[model samples]
Target chain A: MPGFFKNKVFWSGVMALVATLILINMTSSERENITLLERILRDTYAPLQSRVTEMRDYLSGPRSIFIQKQELSERIAELEEEIARLNLSNQILRENEEEIKRLRSIINFRDNNLDKYELLAARVIARSPNNWFQSIIIDKGSIDGIEKNMPVITSKGLVGRVGSISQHTAQVNLITDREIAVGATLQRSRETSGVVEGMVEGNLLKMINIPYYASVKPNDIVITSGLSEVFPKGIDIGVIYQVTEEPNGLLLSATVVPTVNFSKLEEVMVITDFWPVSEETEAELPALAEE
Target chain B: MCYLIHFLLPFLAVFLQSTVFGFYSIKGTLPDLVLVFVICFSIVNGAGKGTVYGFLCGMLEDLYLGRFIGINAIAKALTGYITGRLQKGFFRENIIVGATAVALGTLLNAAVLLVLSRIAFPSFHIDEQFVQGVLYQFAYNIILAAPLYGWYYRSSRIGLLKLPGEK
Candidate 1:
């Protein structure tokens, strides 16, 4: 028995068994907390990581090329002149017409519906190194009312949700992050609730668990479901890129091309005031007395 | 003291790689200086220290990138351990050998990530572009390994810690 125990292979096998048990126990115990911990870690390290990346960029030298070609400069000047001329004409036309009324209506709609959101403008400071994945760092942070879980967007469409916030910087986990899952709906029919998950291959998102009977079609716009209370309702997420029925005939999935080109993100808007519903409102309402 | 340096240096490398050197792409591929640094540290040090450093570096990376929390930790730990074991059989002071090891290590690291990604996400297809990205990164990393090794070697020397066997 002593000689058998003394064999190195026996000890090695024992160690392997212990390790497997430990791993299985850990995985089972921490299954629920893993996502939350991942989020916290992302938030905490994002700023420092961003700062280090900025320093590295500084070390690597300037990124842009200064094209000093005379022809290019002349073409730029001509375009600027044309743009100025168009701006003048447009301004005169706008002044002569009821442009203010149109703007007022739009503002009124936003005020009535999106009153809770206080929008702050920011610039993109950095981007994820991998092209297949999409994420960005913005110059705004907690100091500017930016916070984790805030929704980030551009005029084009939804960009991502804020993952981390430091005093003066925030990290946005773009819609393309594999771990990101957002509740979204089809804008056209508005009949389905689907989970949007990032595809691992490319900068694309896939909506899962759409009811097979829903009237979704190609080119249907997808918007935030507002079920999670993070992103408000009606924020455009993307246009449906493809749709396929599941083999089971119960569920459908679709690929969506995000509206914001994450690679070229320059200016973004961080929503500061997505007012959450009070707990009282969420409480199951007492059954109304029969009318 | 050495453990702290090991932890901090990899963190610093990851930080720089993500923020600053991240944008410096040549033909759409950037050098993974952090991975190279970790591999070098593992080889110069030993398996135990290498595993610790690798895990910490991976944790820091996971924190910043917002990916699966333990994936990097596990990958890096394995990488460091393997590299350290390799170091045991060979001399650690050869720059060319270090560069080749780094190049191979980077390739393996990227491959591990690809396989893990596939396992974690079976719905998506891992394509040629992904493989090309890994190869391009491997080339870029090898190009920069010599300088990175030189820098770390010089710093350790200046600090009066000889190369692993210099004493």
Candidate 2:
């Protein structure tokens, strides 16, 4: 017994085991209510980490000239495409403005009923270790009015929602992670609703519980159903890749190709002020002041 | 100053992993610098200190980027302990020994993470991509092991911490 206690191997093994258990317990606990120690640790160290990142970027800047050149070329091409898009958008908006005037006179619908949202632009400061692309640490946090469940987006489409926050940083759980699910609808029909879940295989998104008879097709656009409180309705989620029938035959699922490139995600906009309108509130909105 | 450097090293490694390393990857696999740090440190520090360093490094990793808590810590601590035990009979300065330790450590780290995530969370599942990623990352870690070992060797020889074999 004394010999066992004296064994260094035994002690090391015991410590490792204990540490493992403690780590698991801490992670599995409810994430919203982070422990005070963890909060303090994150708040205290986040700034230093952010500073170190900036310093590393500054130091590495001179050595990365080739990458910068390649990026500049790509940015030029993207800008050209953007210009074409803006021209098309101008034409569409002119048509929509005329139609909207006619419709507004007839319907008496209020424009302010649309949820007002504030966008906070954040930089991608850090990432998870494994290249799992599950989550990323953004430079925005509670101090920036970023809160848990706020949807993070790129101009292209949905990225993820804010999960945990420190004083100066927040973790954006990517839409590709298994833990996240978005209520989505097929844009072509707009009648079918389903849940888009992150799949482990190929890091793809899967839309589940779609009705078996829904006429979902390849390349059909998917957007937020606004069924959940986390995200507002009509945000672009992804495009359907392939629709498949389940073994049970009651429901259908589709493979979704996420619109946002998780790998190239750098700058994202956080929706800060959007409040989801419940069915009951939406019903009663007409009785209130029109403004 | 030395203690602060020791504390900052893992955080810096993770910070870099999250930011700079995200841009640079080979075949969709990135090197785990913190794991490299643990393996190299264990080889220099021996099993007892290695275990402690591994645990601390892993915890920081979990706090920074891990999806689940403690998975990296458990994997890294075990790897550190095992590599530290290897330090006794093997030449710590040898490149092959250090690189081999890193290879084993990366695989162990991945295996422990996968197995534990499976056990702890019913929602988590494994696939071919995960397996391929683990293998790619293992090779990547091995490729990085030599330079990291060289750096660790040079740092330890600066007479900061007592060398493993030095009396």
Candidate 3:
């Protein structure tokens, strides 16, 4: 054996191999607990990363920003005029809503309960440097009352939930990440339900374990099934692209194309407060409270 | 000051990699500036220092991710070691050599990640998209290798990157 093979460098390599193997064994993608070291590092570096992003945006172009500001002012005026037109239309809609409320009272009908959510707007500050993990870092964090498992959404549809959080920033695993799954249902055929899983690609989602005989097909809209503790019921998930029978013929699966263009995600709304009431909870409610 | 610049280089590279390079991503895969640096440093240095530095950089990446600890660390360190060992057969300062090393390093990095994940977690499955993403990253890393390797090669020539002392 060569003398170099017995040197300190070789011993270091061997030690590293052993330590890394042990570390990999302890690694978990669904880890709920964050250690003190990881927390401090993420918190300390996240701010610098956020500032670098702002600097990049600032240095993009001063002239372009001025032009954009002028255009935005003109657009704001246009929007104000449109808002007045909408206010007239909204007044008529308010009368219709009041009529509906009265009719519902007469019929003892339950209101569609989705707007109970309070949304907090957050900016996309950074994204995962590696492609193996599909996560985005938002500027808002626990300081903004964002917590783990909080559902994140855009105006178009569901994005993902907060996975981990620091003081000033939070990491959201996108719905297309491998480790995330949402309770999904078919909007057209309420009976057709499945779990929407994140796929390797950012655009594609896999709706798994659909009943073999369900009437789901391409163009069918998929929504949240309200079956999970995290995601609210009736939030749009995606449109089914291709439905196919599973290899075993026991269950079917479909490819759902999400409405949210995740790559282009700039601003998102994190649902801060939502207490979903299930049918079980509804039945347990007292009549006096309803009155 | 020089040592501080060298120390903070990985952090800055990673931040810019996630933010600035994110805009230019091709199908969710971007050029990994940290990996490129690892390869360059390994090519200039030897397998021993390359391996240690790769491990540290990978740890930094994992900490930034705040999820898994060793996935990137193991993969990147292995890539650095392999690239460093292979550099013995090449003209280390040549851009082509550097770019070729990057191409191999990127592929090796992806393979190690895939194999490690597959072994550690049964839920993880490799699919067609994984292959496609790796290819896209391979292209991006090669594109980045030229300028990065040139800088490292020149820096080593000027003694900013102190070579490993003889055994």
TM-scores for the candidates = 0.66, 0.82, 0.85
Q: How should the candidates be ordered by lDDT, best one leading?
A: 3, 2, 1
Q: Evaluate every candidate with DockQ and list the scores.
A: 0.25, 0.48, 0.62
Candidate rank order under TM-score: 3, 2, 1
Candidate 2 C-alpha lDDT tens digits along B1-167: 44566777797787667666766766546789999989998888788788888988988877665346777778888889888997788877788889999998888887777777787777777767677777888888888888878877777877554344655
* Candidate 3 structure quality by residue, lDDT tens digits, A186-260: 999899768999887556899998989898989999999877768888889899999999999989999999989
> Can you rank all candidates by DockQ, best first?
3, 2, 1
Chain A TM-score from candidate 2: 0.77
Q: Tens digit of lDDT per residue, candidate 3, span B47-130?
A: 877887888899889878866677888888899999999999788768999999999999899889888888776788877877
Which window of ten consecutive residues has the lowest lDDT sum in model 3 chain A? Answer: A282-291
**Native-to-model Cα distance after best TM-score fit, residue B83 in candidate 3, in Å:** 0.9
TM-score, B chain alone, candidates in order:
0.85, 0.89, 0.92
Q: After superposition, how far is residue A219 of candidate 2 from its true place, in Å?
A: 2.0
Tell me model 1's lDDT, rounded to 2 decimals.
0.68
Chain A fold similarity by TM-score, each prediction:
0.61, 0.77, 0.76
Q: Kindly report the interface RMSD of candidate 3, rounded to 1 decimal.
A: 2.0
> Of 1 and 3, which scores higher on TM-score?
3
lDDT measured at residue A204 in model 3 versus the true structure, 0 to 100: 84
What value does the lDDT take at residue B167 in candidate 3?
A: 20
